[model samples]
Target: MSERLKSFIRERATALGFEACRFASASAPWDAGERLAHFVGEGRHGDMGWMETTLERRAHPTAMWPEAKTAVVLGLNYGPEADPLPQMADRSAGYLSVYARGDDYHEVIKGRLKILAGQMAARTGQDVKVFVDTAPLMEKPLAQRAGLGWQGKHTNLLSRRHGNWLFLGSILTTAEIEPDAPEGEHCGSCTACLDACPTAAFPAPFQLDARRCLSYLTIEFAGPWPEEFRVATGSRIYGCDDCLAVCPWNKFASGAREARLHAREALNAPRLADLLALDDPAFRALFAKSPVKRIGRDRFVRNVLYAAGNSGDAGLVEPVGALLGDPDPVVRDAAAWALRRLEAAGLA
Candidate 1:
């Protein structure tokens, strides 16, 4: 009966556009909680204070919901058509992360998850809950437990099938669905991800310090970044994808099947000069359905200013200089810093 139910759920999830669907015993004991606690204890989470607040509840699946007997982990592939690393060489253009280059995955995946969860509930006569990245459900660990993939050295889920470009969504249920075998770590000797990091975000294999991660700094951190990170940020105006792009597993990956997840041409390699001129309205329109919209214009411009500073393009100096008198204090500071960098580069 459990095997039949798992098959039904997998079929439903696949029909709903999920690339991978596997089940795991959510109630099973695991050490993911201990690692999370250690990460928080060391203050590695940086500005994401919510991680601290939800520590206990995020510790275990049962801690969040005692009735969660099974975990249905789903993966949606969002791989790019080719390697994104080469685009960074065009330093005059801002490099938005591959994930943010398309429509927001949260909106895309959450709706499908809800539909799949509803189907599971009807078939098994069980209560169900759906979660995207927003919830503290630790979808990566659950995905690993479900045999979807292993957590690579970069601390991101690595799939032999889909590689590093899978978006995870989970459905927790009250039904005792048969659990698949858990995936084991396959990152034996490769340190390409750690070596590729511009900010050295990984202190050790499988450990990430969010404080130093450019993705966290560019997206989650609100104010002007520390000077070191600003310089290291290069042309990356949004999230960083160096670690993910350098992963060997991506060789087997293919481009996204979902049309909405395809990269927009405007976002792929936007000119730094153009981006530095974005006001609130322009910024909102440009990133209407993108994940980048969450950061707002001020913060987004701040990131652009840093990229402008690193661009070494004299053309961007005028736009960067104009922001010096801008309203947002952070933007003004970034503008000043950008001007100074340009001056140092003999471009101002």
Candidate 2:
């Protein structure tokens, strides 16, 4: 029965275009929970206070849904059609993480997870629950322990087959299911991911300070960016993937098979100058399906202006300057900074 159920889940996952699937026990690691508490109490999560509330549930899957006995971990590959790093070399063009460049993964992956869950329920009349990253579940550790993959020094999961370009999702089931043997680490002695961090966000291997993460700064952070991190931010307008992209193991990753995750032609090399000209309505029309939409118009513009300031493009100054008097102080302030950058760079 264990082998049969495992085979069943693998077939469904591959049919759904998932790159890999593995299973683990539903219980969370107490040491992981303790480390998380220490990390949060040390103020590593930044202003993400919600992480502090779900201590027990976030640490263990059974705490959230008591009936869960097995966890099915799934990964979907979204590697780029080409090298995504060289785009940053342009410096004047803003860079977005390859994973977030197309449609939002939360809705896409969650909808697929639900269908997969439905299929599992049909096979065995058991209760099931699903979670993408939006949930408080300890998905990375669970995936690592489940033999899906090992969490590398940079803390993202790595696999011999899928590498680090995969999006992770979890399904909790009450059915008695067999777990896969956990995978081992291949990071070896490489410190490329650690040295590449622009803000030095990682104090040690396997840990991250969200407060210094560019992804958190450009997206989740609600107020003014700390001036200290501004220069380091450069032209990255969305999530940072330096650590993920630099992993040598990605040599095994194939380009995205799902067309929806394929990089849009318009997004491949967008001009920072053009993006700064967009008002809210323009921003909405352009990024409707994008993860950036969640940050809203004002916040998105704030990020654009930061990129514009780093662009060193003469054309961006006037467009960014036009936002100086906008109602939102955040936009207005960022625009003023962008204008100064244009002048300082002798591009104005």
Candidate closest to the true structure, highest TM-score:
1
Model 2, span 171-249: residue lDDT tens? 9999888778877787889988888899999989989899999988988897888777777888788888889888888
* Lowest summed lDDT window (length 10), candidate 2: 27-36
Instruction: Tell me the spans in candidate 2 whose CA falls farther than 4 Å from its real position.
Output: 28-30
Native-referenced Cα lDDT, model 1: 0.94
Estimate, for each residue in 1-58, the C-alpha lDDT of model 1 and write its tens digit.
9888878888988899999999999999999999999999999999899999999989
For candidate 1, the 10 contiguous residues with the lowest summed lDDT are 2-11
Candidate 1 ranges with C-alpha deviation above 4 Å: none
Highest lDDT against the true fold, candidate: 1
Q: How well does each candidate superpose onto the true structure, as a TM-score?
A: 0.99, 0.97
TM-score of 2: 0.97
lDDT values, one for every candidate: 0.94, 0.85
Clashes of each: 0, 1
